[model samples]
Target: MPKALVTGAAGFIGFHLCRRLSAEGFEVVGLDAMTDYYDVSLKQARLDLLQGPDFSFVQGRVEEPGLLMRLFSEQRFDLVFHLAAQAGVRHSIEVPRDYLDSNIVGSFELLEAARAYPPRHLLLASTSSAYGANTEMPYRETMRADHQMSFYAATKKATEAMAHSYAHLFALPTTMFRFFTVYGPWGRPDMALFKFTRAILNGDPIDVYNFGDMKRDFTYIDNLVEALWRLAGQPPPPDGKSVCAEDSLSPVAPWRIVNIGNSQPVQLTDFIAAIEAATGRSADRNLIPMQPGDVPATWADTMLLTRLAGPITPIPVDKGVQCFVDWYREYYDC
Candidate 1:
């Protein structure tokens, strides 16, 4: 079995990815800080489901001085999925230092380790927020994304540059996938879907940000994971040539950035309505202005992704919302 090291293995995306890798016959080692960012119990619960002969878990921060180096030396992972980071746009505004430590410095540590002990492919998780201040409707991979609206996005964007430099200098095969509002089973507590579900099920008001004017691509977890799995096999060629007209593959390095999203932006109000439909309970909506470090909209141009991987058929918002609500009811006994 191919060995894989997945950082941030307790996170929403990381947990699902670990499960997918194990199911695909990869011997997976998961590392997590178990930080109390949301609920440690929830993280533990996710970890509990991952215990098996093919999977192992380690608890530690990715920014630790030599933790990654030790793991790389020991495991010599065939594939390294770097999903660990300080997530949340609004939270980053309040705790910018955390973003620096986890996103930037943590990525540096991972890169340095990978440099010392190279992997076949290094996949890093980025966010659509990195496309901040771009007014374009469908965000293509080759577009210029110099302006970032939040510290969270700024740090993530910085990682893309950092990873590119490493790939150019060290000839590492790297892929940075930009996620757009991922949601589904085992989602983050701080995300809108989780918070809204809890509030609506409890007969409490849900905060509708941007006065319900915002829109998001809202890629489901399963779809995103599938895209990632397919992408792992489609690493950029070492020749540094474009794969397609819309490809973001760097001309000087075996590095590329792909947008993994639904490519269909849904209004925030419609998302809440999906939840209401799923729970059979009407939401008490509290219309609110957009928070600091929050964008009004996000849409992805997945042409490059389609060209690289095969066609991606994303789950509809209603179906994905229903799945989450069903899981929430069973998990929380609501």
Candidate 2:
């Protein structure tokens, strides 16, 4: 079996990917800092489900000096998934240093490690937030994303540049996938779906930002995981040849950026209605202005993703929200 090292293995996406990889017969080493960013217990619960013969867990931060180097030297990972980072746009306003440390510095550490002990394929998690101030209806990989509205987006964008340079010099096959508003079961507490479900079920008010006028592509976890799995096997060659014209493949390096999204942007109000229908309760909306560093919308241009991973059928927001509500009630005993 091939060996894989997944950073931030306890994170929402990392946890899901680790489970899928382990089940597919890969020897997976899962590392997480276990920080109290939101709820460490929730991360721990996710980690619990990943315990098995094919999986091993390490409690450490990716930015810890020499950590990735030692691990890379010993394991010689066939695949490296760098999914761990300080996530959240609003929170980035409160603590910009955390994003710099985890997203920027941590990614730099990973690139250095890969430079020394290169993996067959290296994938990093970026966000649609990296699109930043671009008002483009459907964000494509080839678009200019230099103007990041938030510190979080800036840090993520920095990582993409950092990884590309390494790929150029070291010949490492790198992929930077930008995820649109991801939501589903085992979702983070900081996300809108989880907060809305919890507040609605408990008869509390849900914060409806931008007066409920915001829109998001809202990709489901399962669909995102499937896209990731397909992309894992399809890494760019060092020669920089691409499969499509719209490919974001770097001209000088074996690196590319793909957007994984539903390709169907849903209104915030409609999303809340989905939660209300799923939980059989109505939300007490506390309508508010858009928070800092928040755009009114985010939609992904998934043409490259389809070309790279084949056709994709994304779950509707209603169905996805229903599944999440069901899991939330069962897990939290609401």
After aligning candidate 2 to the native by TM-score, how far in Å is the CA of 186 from where it should be?
0.6
lDDT of 1 at 68: 96
Question: What residue pairs are clashing in model 1?
Answer: none
- RMSD each, Å: 0.6, 0.7
Task: Estimate, for each residue in 71-152, the C-alpha lDDT of model 1 and write its tens digit.
Answer: 9999999999999999999899888999999999999999999999999999999999999899988998888999999999
lDDT of 2 by residue, 1-334 (tens): 8999999999899999998998888999999999998898999999999999999998898888899999999999999999999999999999999999999889998999999999999999999999989996788899999899999999999899999999999899999999999999999999999888988989999989999999999999999999999999989877778888999999999999999999999999999999999999888999999999999999999999998899989898899999999999899987
Name the weakest run of 10 consecutive residues (lDDT summed) in model 1: 240-249
lDDT of 1: 0.94
Superposed Cα RMSD, model 2: 0.7
- Name model 2 segments beyond 4 Å from true: none
Give the TM-score (vs. native) of candidate 2: 0.99
TM-score for candidate 1: 0.99
Q: TM per model?
A: 0.99, 0.99
Q: Taking the candidates one at a time, how many backbone clashes does each contain?
A: 0, 0
